[model samples]
Target: MRLQLNSSSHTPLYLQLEAALRERLASGEWRSGQALPPERELAQQLGVSRITLRRALERLEDEGLLIRRQGSGTYVSQRVEQTLTALTGFSQDMAARGLRASSRWLQRGIFRATPEEALAFGLSPTAEVSRLERLRLTEDEPMALELAALPVRYLPDPQAVGDSLYAYLDLHGLRPVRALQRLRAVAALPRVAELLAIRPGDPVLYIERLSYLPDGSVLEFTRSHYRGDRYDFVAELKGGK
Candidate 1:
């Protein structure tokens, strides 16, 4: 594989490396569990500093897209396990792990839906939606700030919804059978930093998840801000295919 760097591009050299490698992965040039060239070799081949190459690889590893072994080498990460199966609620997952989970509800009100909200929940933009904003905790440690909006027509009383949105769905038989989630790394904002008790500019996980019921009805549109230092995406995978 050939890696190119543009010294003139304002983007950092490490980020450039990340982009090149990600492109290779996306194009199927590198398959899962495939070993990457050694840091020194790749650095020399790309005419860049070893430090830059190492930093790039480390970033990918942190993202769970690569696996590094001490004294061995680095390789592309295998896909996460059980990603295609199971739809468990956060509260239930935490409880199953012997951890206590709770939420500090911030806002509970029915508000006019925005265009984005309407599209996400399959409702009219002028329709009302139940908005929920809360800080979540596990073992008394702040983990995530969850902001969710549900169609008010489906849930009449905002006060009735509690910490576990899934519980409310289950009671009404609207539990989601599947969901689509997107995650990105972002800097913590002032208000979110204050709530998570972290400094501004600290790394945070931005997750947007849209869940739907078995009948294909949109149940919830949630955006959660998770502390990068405290939360991780864990997956288990099988190899034999």
Candidate 2:
């Protein structure tokens, strides 16, 4: 790719470089998963210092537009966009995009509610809850790690849960009518990094949700860690026109 740097411009070299690279990606000059040119060669070709080039690249990596493997080279990232206005399960979201969603159950059993869970679900201190943790995937690619809890009254048989938790609930007429969700960005801890296949300290989307039945009874409490490089969440706001 031919990139021109305006030495006469007041913009910092790194920022200019970042903008140019971003434009290239936006224009489809480099497709997802395509390896970028080596640092040394590209630095020399652009007549910019290695530090400047690396800074620009690092910014992109942080924004989830690129991935840099330790020994392997850097490549463009493949990401998915999710809308925040809908209350949907991982399987349903993936299906809407024509992608297959699957999960690997990590833990499932009935357990006494923790202090936090008890408060969030409005259960008694000694109340029992069914907890389920799984690694959610799309097209076999690791996407998010989910930990969900429900009142034992609703999900008595943890073993009966399958690929889609919502489907399981629907069959038993326990499907929730609405949900409240909160999302924030967090640095992945070591174990979370291992499960998501990203380096520790990498950015991830941490989401917590509470679902409610039509009668306003709390139905589910779910916490999810989504891969920052592979996902984007969008929200639409309306103002007086």
Candidate 1 local lDDT, 29-61, one digit each (tens): 777667888888978877788888888888887
Please report, as a residue range, the 10-residue window in candidate 2 with the lowest summed lDDT. 1-10
Write one digit per residue (lDDT tens) for candidate 2, span 23-42. 98899888866888899988
Point out where model 2 deviates above 4 Å.
5-18, 28-59, 68-74
User: Tell me, what's the RMSD of every candidate?
Assistant: 10.8, 3.5
Instruction: Give lDDT: candidate 2, residue 106.
Output: 93
Candidate whose lDDT is highest: 2
